[model samples]
Target: MATCTVALTAIDSSSRQSLEYSSANQSPESDDEAPRMSLLRKLAVIIQLSGVNFASSAVNGLVVVGLPTITADLKLDPSLAFWPTSVSSLANASTILLAGSVADSIGPRPVNIAGGVVTGAFILAAGACKTGPQLIVMRALQGIGYAMHLVSSVAIVTHTLPRGRPRNFAFSCLGLSQPLGFSFGLVLGGILQDLIGWRAAWYIYGGLTLALSVVAAWALPNFQNEGTFKGTMRNLKVRVDWVGALLASIFMTLLSYLFAIRDPKSIVFICLIAMSLPLFVGWVHRQVKLGKPALIPNALWKDTAFSSICGTVALSFGVTTCMELFASLFFQEVQHLSPLQTGLRIMPSLLVGVALNVTTGLFVHRVPALWIVTVSSIICSVAPLLMAVIKVQSPYWANAFIAQVLAPMSTDVLFTVGLIIISDNFPDNTQALAGAVFNTASQLGQALTLGIMQIVSTLVTKDYSDKILPMARLEGLRASFWTMFGFMMLCTLWGAIGLRNTGRVGLKRD
Candidate 1:
């Protein structure tokens, strides 16, 4: 696999070079401008971009911490309660590719502002939802907005910062926002649940998003596709692959819907999953035929570095998310901790992540990203394995705390490094696409894997009702950890074998 990936990398490099040579004669609109802002101004822009990431992460974290309260308050069937998170992830996974394509064509600034507005509105509306179905609809809309925010935020960062130290630093700060926001959400969600009620979490999230929208409008630059086409409707229509985007969205939506449905035995669900396979194949074929305007250009598959990193990142994200969800349940149900206590207990991991985020940013360009991934993979694998051994009577400091700390160390490092690798390999034209693919994989990984794991947990724990013995339900949670352990082991092997030890931007390659 490593050898095959290396060969593909070579092919992709040569092909990209050839393509660039052929396009050399084209007229230029404007290449990326060199950064001219003072350090304070640059930091302010970074804060704005990172704030978008922070808002998204905060929402996700709130879901994780507040799900139990939501389930109880909304009178949701325990089995169906996962829908709020799963549905949002499904919507995000389905739309992100199209969002990235749109960002590339129209520029990131508009997407950022528009996405923030939509996300804020939907989240605020979600606070008023009276039924599970209403919440699902609002969450799905919020997901679309999040997809826009995610892809465009990364594009803006990559576009604004040149390769090397500044870009690395910016990327690291963006990465840091995820954990920072997540930690804040966990605490805030717990407080709201205890004080004002779970609905307050949504109100706070919505308010933050609205503020970020204003910041994005003021901070983001409106960089166009340099020399690609004039701002005419005909040219715009020709440049954007509407058909490809539609097909890709349909395929992902079908795929996500298949996983979201609880009934694996349902003929309709099975048929949808089966149908998506062909739709996906057709989308790939369409992209191949369409060339430049394709939602996902054919050239991306040939870029071995990008492809490998995407796969590894997806799997890692899936396992990590699954573990987090299960752990949250374990803390609340088996250990009988309050939501606030659970949030506080999870803090050590975020602290570790903060330190590593800084370390990764400062050293990523000096180190080979694959090495960081490989080491993190190994550590991540052990964390889940430890969780699998934990019992209802296990000590918090000895079992849960250690795993939390080790787990985030791996996830935070991998996430930061993964973004850096994606930004480094792709050119400016496809930066948004690359970001979209990266984030889509992360969201899909969470949605699909968590869906599967939820089903497994339900089945595994069904024999012992929570009414009979609360600790009995943990049997399934432990099983999920073991399953995550297996996935992490696979990620470790893939990182070691399939991934190349590529140095970050401007580093000397041996």
Candidate 2:
């Protein structure tokens, strides 16, 4: 895995060269008066970035929304069926650094385009798979493509755009991608799966992504020898920790595996902790001592701002992912809503998240990021705690809907603040790695939450029959909320202390 520190060093050196070259040749007045990009061009960039986000997030949403359907259709064990999603996430988390390195060697544009194409191809192939093994294989490939697209897209935004209005607006544009795509995917995936089947849904998603890949290849700018894109591919010296990557992948796989085994609560807990815990600890130690190019750099551990923001992002994602996963189960099993109905109900939260992201983009340069993050964290903590108080007979408006709304509003605000905080702290060159760090943390957080929730939900249901009623299942879900609420509190306190109050203009890179 590529560390943010190494990436930062590369970005800083290139930016310094650009500044020096500009000072030597251009008059200060002329440099200041260089023509600003038009509204149309800016919009074009935003659209492209959003498109990139759309493709990646939509795929994730599809996997999440369609997982149960796939399991039923294939008659596979839920744990076995889950590998398609879990392995894909692992592939994505593990491959980001290699993708970042590729972005540094080549321009971000081609890398983004290539990723889009590969994602399209693999998703289509996944749809065609007839067996679980084939589907898992295809999903793993799709994960690799997702890692490439995300890393390249962020790098392109960081390198190609100027640092003020354009960058902020681009951040807003990129931010719109996940929530909106997820919202749209859930609704559409449900509808499509109902009417045309899940396989057809995958086909449609693949085709749409293919179209975006083509447009991106044509419309996006290429950076070759440019300041942010500066690199000598022929002499690239950074090494990758293949062994560490392998161990990390295995550790994550085994951890998820332990969770999937439906065993006695105490036995499952003991087994997972005894086996996977030590494996992970060993992986971390190996990365620290034996890694040549460490998967994640140790230097980043010392950077307060970077570590805090990464933790914030991880917690935010953990809360959001767990909520979405459990809530869908609640609606289907407890509330008696069909998947289609559940998707429709969830649409508002997704839309609200998009609106908040765009709004955050506009206000990031004006408001203190610390304030936004803190407020969002407070909202997250309060919402779930409120939801936990509701009785089985409580109205949706009084408890469920209010909790749902807060989730998106809180997540959007918190995620945007953390993104800006991390982006500002890392140098432009390392911006891609910074994104990888943030995203990896985000995915890992989600995975951990899922594992934890699986345990909680299973244990709570043991007193009941295997065919647990929805309302009864919800009672178990309330236990998980306590965990999420604790995460929010920790993040809130961390943001309050760690996020710096840079001047309310352009943010300063640490």
Candidate 3:
């Protein structure tokens, strides 16, 4: 049987070559090469890609508003309620690099379609889950699919659009989709939970995903490497470093576990978490030794601008996600707001984010990304600090509203500028990988920092009863906000000092 299998494989390879030769000899009209795509086609593709991103972001937004409802419905321990969100982020962080590599090795089209279908299936499955564990597992699967979709979608945009105004505009639209989708999901989830149940929110997400999967299959162009199938397969087989992949996965898993685990104060867990640093360092060294087929090439590390941008993204975005999670809890438990009310309250920030992203997308090409990131980071810190100082009876307009407006502006600017920097720095071949790394940093930042903040909050407000007074709970939340403020300020400093000025117009590639 083995002998026959090998023989069949060899025969298939030879047949593929024959087909390639025949196709190569075909007439010139058989392949009408267009140097540039029509503007309409470009817009259509960008819209579709952005739509997919919107779907993913909407799902994340649903989790934000739906989490309290889910916890109540499932009769979950409040401490464990965070698992649903953290699991998804953990899965995405761990698998993103591999997904990017696959997209690069094959093509973005297949990865995008497959990711959407898988995400839809798992999310639908999650809607019917009876236990917290089941829901967490399903969400993790959804995260894997989301990672594939995100990496490929970003790569497609970078690959399709040239590196100037069109690319910048496309990236801005892509960034804008996140806040828009998130806002839509927040409102939709709350409305659905009020009308039907929290489960309905998952159903909606699943249905949309399945529909988008079909649309993507039709709309996405096959920009696979131009070569015989056999040759492409051979290249993929030889270039994929399985050892590096395994090590990286192990490293990411340990790091994620270190952050996501609820009992951060446990001595054993702390030791285990501490061990991951050495493993990570070793993984980097191995990648350096492995050279070409490395999971993360050395060239990426050499790019100081890329490193600075990624660090800034992780810090700033991490704080943003943590703030949203905690703020949702505060609105529901402390202020005793309904899910719908919480969504409505947060709408202004999302709207501001969308508007800012649009404006940035239109004109960011004229400014240095470093300056945008630095100025935004400084302004963004004020929101959390303001939140930390707010009293229970503070006026909404004086405190929450102002903070909300400022928060989104920073997030939008930082995200758009970071994407622009990445898109400009990396070549077409590694665009997917670049997107994956950037997203991984964001996810890990969320997972790790949020975990730390939760621990800090717990420790500071240990005397407060979780089941009792709202004021007690507010104390811990305030502590977390202070921590968030500190981190944001540090990110501001990093941006100011570390990021290089890339000139006034377009990206300055190092």
Sort by TM-score, top down from the best? 1, 3, 2
Q: Over the stretch 420-483, how does candidate 3's per-residue lDDT look in tens digits?
A: 6665566556677778888888878878887778787776677676646788888889999999
Clashes of each: 1, 5, 0
Q: Across residues 208-285, which tens digit of lDDT does each residue of candidate 1 receive?
A: 889978877766665745234456355357766777677677767876776666664657766766776566667767
Give the Å shift of residue 100 in candidate 2. Answer: 1.6
Estimate candidate 3's alpha-carbon lDDT, on a 0 to 1 scale: 0.74
The 0-to-1 C-alpha lDDT of every candidate, in the order given, reads 0.74, 0.67, 0.74
lDDT per residue for candidate 2 within 1-510, as digits (tens), equals 132233323333434433433423222322221123333443455576677577667766777777778777766665576576666766776677667655654556777888888888998998898877888889889988888888777776666544554456566667778888887778888899888888877887789888888778666664542233224433144434455555555555555455556656647556655675456456656667864455555566677767877777777877887777666766666776777887876676786786788777667778866677777888877766766676666777787787778877556775656666666655555566556666677776666666677777667765555554665577677777777788788878887777765335344232
- For model 2, the stretches where C-alpha displacement exceeds 4 angstroms are 1-42, 225-296, 391-393, 466-472, 500-510
Tell me the lDDT of model 2 at 253.
54
List candidate 1 stretches off by more than 4 Å: 1-32, 225-232, 264-267, 282-292, 465-467, 501-510
Error of 2 at 294 (Å): 6.2
